[model samples]
Target: MRVAYYCQHVLGMGHFFRSLEIAKALADHEVDLISGGPEVRAELPPHVSLFRLPGLMMNDDFSELYPLEPGRSLEEVKNERARLLSERFLLFSPDLFLVELFPFGRNQFSFELLPLLQDIRDGHFGPVKVVCSLRDILVEKSNQEKYEARVVKRLNEFFNLLAVHADPALLRLDETFGSLDRVRIPVRYTGFVTTKPRSGAGIALRRELGLEPSQKLIVASIGGGKVGGRLLFAALQAFARLGLSGARMHVFSGPYMEASEFLALEKLASAIPGVILEHFTDRFLDYLDAADLSLSQAGYNTAMNILATGVPALVWPFDQNHEQRLRAEKLKQLGVLGILEDADLESERLAVRMAQAMEAGRRSGPAPVDLDGAANTARLLQDLAS
Candidate 1:
């Protein structure tokens, strides 16, 4: 089977990474991943190929769309994207169309997506199984009733299935979207999609870092780094205050952090000993596995990584929406991680929390939530195709 996966990440890289994991899991099928957000560095599997659309992203506030290429008007980019998407649909003629966070989210791209969905509905791409790949929680909209109605209408009209990438035991689509019963389609929970780190990778990494058994290794990161400067800066300050002997901290500022913010973080980190800062790394999971403690935002991908590695984590949920906070609260109840509050950002308080989290050590035993979402998603798509 050939799968054409459409993913548009306007603000963060979480959606892209999660979609990539699912594509990787579909090794038995050929995958054409359509992406239009800011370019990200990743290693694609042999069976998966990326189809880049003219870059389009949201403003910091996510109020409007802008072209990534300078001097190109938003209208020009949208027109080109629409044309390319239709052309690709005809060329690939994929058996499955896996759309990430559409109807549920990424409604900004409706000018392109709605047309493509319409074309597929008209049998322009032959018989294709249309699936909506959604995350666990949704950001509350300005008019939720209208939003739910629109989603139900779109899903029923164009989509064949709704594959929510969450463990229903932890979160269900209806919990966030109230009109689930109104949608006339199959909605399957494919667990939480994440790539598990290689076996013993963390242990090997710890040894390679030449760390003593007594020394603590803390890993800190901000997903995409566009809005995580506060958390990273605060974490660095807290680390400095900890003053723990033989402790090492690795901070990934994320690839998208503004240069000014990253430079500021670099300057601050340079003053502290045993602190290493980098823009990004492909071996994020390995580092998480090797870490004694993890500090970061509570996005779906990061939360899944913490769960996959069983690392003791302290997450500062994104304040703009209830998505991260709600997920973090669930993990907290499961004793899988701790949440960070605004007052906790104070260096002194954060330092204390850091110490306590490290002292508590890595989470032990099995993960409370299902972590086989990537493979399960592949299986579901394949079964549907069959």
Candidate 2:
């Protein structure tokens, strides 16, 4: 079966990577992956092909839309993207057309997505199975009820399935999108989509990085580096206060952090004996596996990685959107992670949590949450195709 997977990641790399994981899981079949965002380096499996469209990114607060290209008009770019998307939908003629986030999120790309859906509804792409590949939690809108009503209208008209990459035991759709019953389509829980580490990858990486046995390893990161400066900044202060504690810190400030902030972190790390700072690494999960503890933002991909590794973690959820807050709360309730409040991001408060996390040591044993989402998503796609 041929599948066309569309994903647009505006702020972070989470959506792109999650979509990639599902595409990899369906590696037994032909997959055409469509990405409509700024370029990112990602490893793709043999069965997948990529079709990158003209990119768009939102401002920091998601208040405005802009073209990724310098000095280009947003309308021109949007038109081009819409044209390309329509062309691809017709050419690929996929048995299944999977969209990462729509109606629920990525409403910015409605110019293209709505048209694509119309084509499917009009049978331009005959008998194609349309699905929404959504993350576990959704961001609550300002006017949620009206927003959901519009979403329900779209889903009932165009979508055949809703593939939620979450375990119902942990969180259900209704918890976030309260109008769940109005979706009017089949919803399938595909476990918690996460990539499992390779056997002995942690041990191998430790040896490669020359980490000593007696030294405690701490991995700190901010996904995509768009808005994690506060958390990353606080961590630096916390680590500095706990100096010479035999703990080696590795910090990934994220790829999109401002130059000023990243430079500050670099200078700070240079003065610190055991702290190493870098911009980004694709081997993020491996680093988490090698760490005694993880300090990071509570994004979907990072949280799932923390859970899969069963590493003791301290997370500061992005309070602006209830998405991260809800996810962090649920995971904290499950005992996999500890929360660091927005009120207490200062060095003194974080140092206390840091010390406590270090003293607790590695969290050994199997993870309590399901990690079979990638595989299960593939199984469902096959079922839908049949």
Candidate 3:
């Protein structure tokens, strides 16, 4: 079987990363990936092929924004992508064509998916099942509740299934969208998408960074290029003030962080006895494994990674939108994460939160959240193809 997977995400690597996991699950099938976002270095399984759309990103300048990237709009780039895909779609026509959460997300850009879905439904396209895959939450941003209901209706009519890759035991994000039709599809809560670690691996990424056994590790990450220096600086201050003696810290300031700014942070770390700061390294999770605590802006992929790693982290969420803060609240309520608002987060308070969480973490284990979904998700996709 061959499957076509589509995703267009901006700012964070969550969408792409999740899609990658699904693609990995279907390694036996011929899968084609259609993505639109800033370029990222991801290890694609050998069976999957990539089709890059016009590089797209969210336009923070305007409200209700998903601006076309410069040098080429994803629309124009999408044309070439579509042209290339149309041929392959007809030739390798698969059992399913799965869209990752935004036959509704593009909002403005989804004008293309409807026609494609119509073709599939009307039998104009090859024999295929179209599925809409969504993550646990959908922070319904721009569209009015009524409009989303309409979109759900449209999706229900066109797609074969609405796969909610999250546990129903978790909170329902559909309430926020209020689309009975969309919610009513052959909806399957496939559990959360978390990458399982290679078990029994005790590789200490902290020791790799030259930290001693006595020092505590703090693995901090800001996704590749889009981190706020001011926000991160505040977290660093917190780490510093927390003042755990002989603690060794490792900071990953993503690719986009300014070199000059990072150099300053590195210098600051050097002054400290055991703190270390470096540009974002490819060894992200390894460092995560080595750390006693983690600190990052709350993003879906980052949050999932932390949870999957089962480490206690202080999530200092961005004030960009309420969704991040909302999740932060949920994690805080669960006592799985510590929260610090952007405006109010200080190094001193952060230090207190971290010191407390880590000291407590030593005694207790990760919360009783079941992440057995990835394997189940693999089985489901495999069954779909079969």
Highest TM-score model number: 1
As for TM-score, the candidate ahead, 1 or 3, is 1
lDDT winner between candidates 1 and 2: 1
**In terms of TM-score, which candidate is stronger, 2 or 3?**
2
Stretches of candidate 2 off by over 4 Å are none
Angstrom error of the Cα, residue 229, model 2: value is 0.8
Q: Pick the candidate with the highest lDDT.
A: 1
Model 1 clashing residue pairs (backbone): none
lDDT of 1: 0.92
Model 1 Cα shift for residue 209 (angstroms): 1.4
Residue range 1-386, candidate 1, lDDT tens digits: 99999999988899999999999999988999999999999999999999999999898878999998999999999999999999998999899999998988888899999998998899887899899999999989999999999999999999999998888888988888999999899989999999898999999999999988888899999989888789889999999998889999999999889999889899999999999999999999999999999999999999999999999899999998899999999889999999999999999999999999988888778788889999999999989999
- Residue-by-residue lDDT tens digits, candidate 3, 1-386: 77888887676667887888888887667888888777767888899988776665665532343335556654566566556556656665767888887655666555557667777888876577778878766564555766786667767787767777766665565655566444556776777776764543325554555667667888777776465566567667777777777777677777656678888777776776666676656566666666788878877667766777777687777666666776677667766787766545666766777788788773146544556555656566666656
Cα shift from native, residue 224, model 3 (Å):
4.0
Pull out the clashing pairs in model 2.
Answer: none
**Model 2 compared with the native: what TM-score?**
0.97
True-structure lDDT of candidate 2: 0.88
Model 3: which residue pairs collide? 102-105, 225-256, 237-347, 238-347
